[model samples]
Target: MGPLNVSLCMIVRDEEAFLERCLASAAGIVSEIIIVDTGSVDGSREIAKRFGAEVLEFPWSGDFAAARNAGLQRASGQWILVMDADERLLAVNEAAWASLLRQDTAGYYVKLISYVGDRTGGDYVTDYACRLFRNDARIRFEGMIHEEVVTSIRRLPEPEGIIRPSPITIAHDGYLEPVLARKNKKRRNMDIIREALRRTPDDPVLHYALGSEFFQNGHYAAAAAAFQATLPHISPREGYASDLMLKTAYALRETGERAQARRLVEKAVAHYPDFTDLLELQAILLMDDEQYASSLLPLASALRIGADVQRQYLYNSASGSGTYQTRYLTGLAYERMYRWEDAHEQYEAAIADRADYMPVWHRWPVIALLLGRTADMQRLMYAQAARLPRSAWSLTANVWMNGQQTDALREMAERCEALRAEATVLRAVALAQDGADGQAIDLLLPAASRGNSGDALLYVWALYMKTGASREAAACLKREAGGNPALRAMAGLISGEGAEVREEAYRLCQQTLMQLAAWDCLDALHAQLPAQLPYPWLPLHAMYGYLHAPFASKRELLAQCTRRFAALGYAEQLAAGLLALECGGFAEAAAWFAAAGRQAPDRTAPRIGTVHAHAAMAQEAARGYGLPALSSDYRFLSICDR
Candidate 1:
């Protein structure tokens, strides 16, 4: 009946550049601003004070929840919108916020949109985060870095804390800054994660946090090892298993272990086949491994499950080398089989999803030309021309896209002549794509001569494939390795050159051991190393089989992987349920998931499969099937939107 008074609460440290922007985003909506400055020397307190934000000085207690709780205690508003200094509320969702606060909702969930790296929007848009809630007394916080409040919400009784959905997003741009700053931040997070790991050696979240923290710091191998450590601690039927499995697979893939990554991802899907993240990651990894055909399963799974509209756009853009990447891949698949219109529809659908994605615009013209749709080719070419950037690549695209009869070819040749060695290699590929193998060779040779060892190796390999010179390509790869440490390592791993392969493997093994030791787990380090010497590293499957097989071979290890994989799915559900329990005042749901691992043997090995509902049940079983309640007679019904 009355306007709801909302508080803006945040815990910040050294956030000067974007703190003002964050506060400004929510300025007009909040009744008060509570800022807890944890040892910020970066003008953060002064900036908050300028906006009439109540600045509370708190020494860094190495605990985020404590600072946040302190901020909450000082707030007077009836509802709280929690935001970090590096995060900003989107202007587009202002109306939704106003409506949400005015309603009788106990707490609201706000979506988080992250900008991966580039401001121009390429190669990113990774995840969403929940950032809104009621200023209810029941909600409390926990943990340090990546702290959450939902854990405390489970202690509430009755229907006073029901979760209401809020259609708003907070834009996170922390990753867009300089790489060094990002690295430094990750280093700090690593300390916190390591501490958490020490405190709870068997905690899956802590292991995952440590792994992810390592990955964020670009220590890919360390990340894989850390993620692997979490696998043994999971209670198979618990909900967080999927997330741990997915992240582990992601780390492996990023470390050039695509086969292992793909296999692990497949394992995740086997457990929860419809999990959108699993499906997407599987497709992405398959494409990177150049397994175009294998990529289709997860790609189609993603489509069949109907992902978010934004994600659907990304899935359709995946066609760099595979049909699973975009609809054009589907069309191209059909075209390969001479199913013309089917291919056309797939291409058309891909373009419709987002013409901005490179694959659709590039292929439509080429595909049209092949199908004798000259008119369609011309139309598509003009559309592409309008959208293409005014770069050297676009010039080629314009020529190729326009059903290039004569002038385009001449211009392309001239451009090829003008480009540098690296650019020339690219042009040669373009020329090859245009069916001018001889000219492509001409462009490729000179380019290869002037290129770096890496580029030269690629050129030689391409030439070998183009000219049917397998021996030459192999020899070139060997020669390139003599001059490049990175290449030498990659080549040894792939070619089975015993001495070099052993050397590289030893390094990886040593690094892995060091990571495990640093994180305080020696047995885990031993388990990761293969029993036999000179392990196969040709395809990723061999590598994955080596890392996971030893563990998967033992039933106890297998069960643990299953439980851990399941636990991740449970964690997400728990996050939502915890939020609901806090807002909805339903204590049972909280107690149901919070209690620890006593999952039943009959519950399918979590690695085999599970749905969200199944994951919830598995999590409950992991909690010993005795969900805590506010009162003896209270039976908490989980608020699930089926």
Candidate 2:
């Protein structure tokens, strides 16, 4: 029935750019405004005054808590709402604030969304902070850098001290790239943190704060060290301990210490088995190692436990470890296992939960194609075209997939002509795919004329070769190759110049040759490649096997690639075994698959591969007795079609 009497408090310095916007956002709701200026050369003070704020001057003390406390002292309202000049309070109905004031709590945790790059959509981090609190002498801010009043609130009487979630939301853009670049905020914070640490050397909170700052600044090694140092001092009851462990593991992983990262995660999971964030991290680590089956249990645990544990005050576990994410990851694992039906089901569930998740949309068509669900694939393409109407790839794919002929494609291309090179390339590829080499060439000529012989130019050359225009193809290749030794060698070979292929050239040309389906050229390139392929070439070998092998010869080629990968210690044994089985190497494939199954019994790939291999061997043996065909063999054949 009456005003809530909220005081909006802020500490600012050179925040003229955002001060007015921040004040305007809260002007209607706040009863009084307290602005503690730490020294602003700009019009920040005038901006605050314009908003009828009670402006007080405070000398720069290099302590955020001290400045914040100064603002807190001047506040004269029943409720105090803390905010920065770079933050704006979201519009909430007055009834929500009235309801919040009715609660018997000392403080409330307001949701804070900090944008890093793009402000639109969900490209930001979610945090919860005690920004709303009773304006009492007992509650005051503390800490030098990452200051807080929550610790003081916790010292109040039990029932009166409860801090609960409020409807209040704040959007902070101080951490965005452009804003961060404008000021040396990290350096200033680091200085304050170091000074504070020097004063209180045993403070786990300072260590944690320092680690978080380092992580934000991309100092992974320093962040890892700081986070690791806090472990011994951190209490299990501390809400941030789980987050610290997660950050430390992530930092370690970034520094190429994945084993150490995994060990840390394992240790953390052992301690806090119910923490869904920890389980999700474990699942992700296992998935990264290609231990898909092993990943499923942790994923299942993560999903079963759900995101109930709010262990961290700053990080939102729901961003990546939510139900939709878990289902999506499970689907990916199923896909790797070649369990198309199971993968599709999980993917569909994920899409149902969050249709706007772009990765799910992208993978839907691929899964549909693999499962021979042409109608489903067409539906997905059309959906993508509608959702992303401006996307050239989506438009082209939709046109190509639907009953739209070259005329429709041309119309689409015309619509996208103003978009430049990317659109042109998409249209050309569509034309090329439709066997209109001349039309594709004509579409590519403008790009070629501008001396832009990138991938599109190479694609145009491939089209010329397809059309039997040898001289034109040679000329295009020569122009596009330029000074690049790899492309030059490729051009030389194509032009019948008898150029010797350099190892680098062969590596470079592999992609283009694959794209062109120039099997003979790939064969020549392969001969020039090193006998002992580097670790990075393992995927290239796999790609070569996929492109080169026909249905009848696929297993043998895949087995050869698998053996090479195995020799390099880079192949997932289950993947290799599947290839071996496809190639009819029953004994070796069966042995490897069994070993894999023994290692990860929960994994579906080895189990399915083993069943199909056994069935294939049985079917082969039964051929002598003229027995009926096996359904397992047919199922395996369907999987191998792609």
Please report the candidate that would top TM-score against the real structure: 2
What are the lDDT figures for the candidates, one per model?
Answer: 0.54, 0.69
TM-scores, one per candidate: 0.55, 0.76
Off by over 4 Å in 1: 1-4, 92-95, 102-106, 126-128, 158-161, 177-183, 217-220, 232-241, 252-267, 283-297, 307-351, 358-378, 381-395, 398-642
lDDT score, candidate 1: 0.54
- Cα lDDT tens digits, model 2, 1-642, are 344699999998999999999998888888899999988999999999998999999998888899999999999999999999999989887788888987778988988888776453444667788999999999999888778988888888877778988778899888887788787787888898999999999899999999999999899999999998998888766767778888899899888888999999998888777766677778878877878799889888877765455444344554546567888888887766566678787777676555555566556544554455545644443455433333434533432323223344455556543334466765775575565667878888888788663467776776676666778878877877787777787677655565655556554455444444444444444444444644334223323223223444445444455545444331345555655665667666777667667777765556666776776688778875765544432233223212
Ten contiguous residues with the weakest lDDT in model 2: 633-642
lDDT of 1 by residue, 1-642 (tens): 222487889988878888999988888777889999888878998899988999988888777778998988888887888998878877745655567767865565555555554562443443423356667677878777678765555456656555554566677776654633743776777777777777768767777778777776678899899888888777545435666787788888878888889778777777776566667677677656545466666667666655344322211111222222445455544443334556666776665554555555544544444445545644553455444333433433332423333334344435443233235444554454455656765655655566652254454544554455657756765665677675565444434453343545344433322211111122232334333434321111111111212222223332222334334343223332332233332343334234311242222111112222334455556775664432211111111110
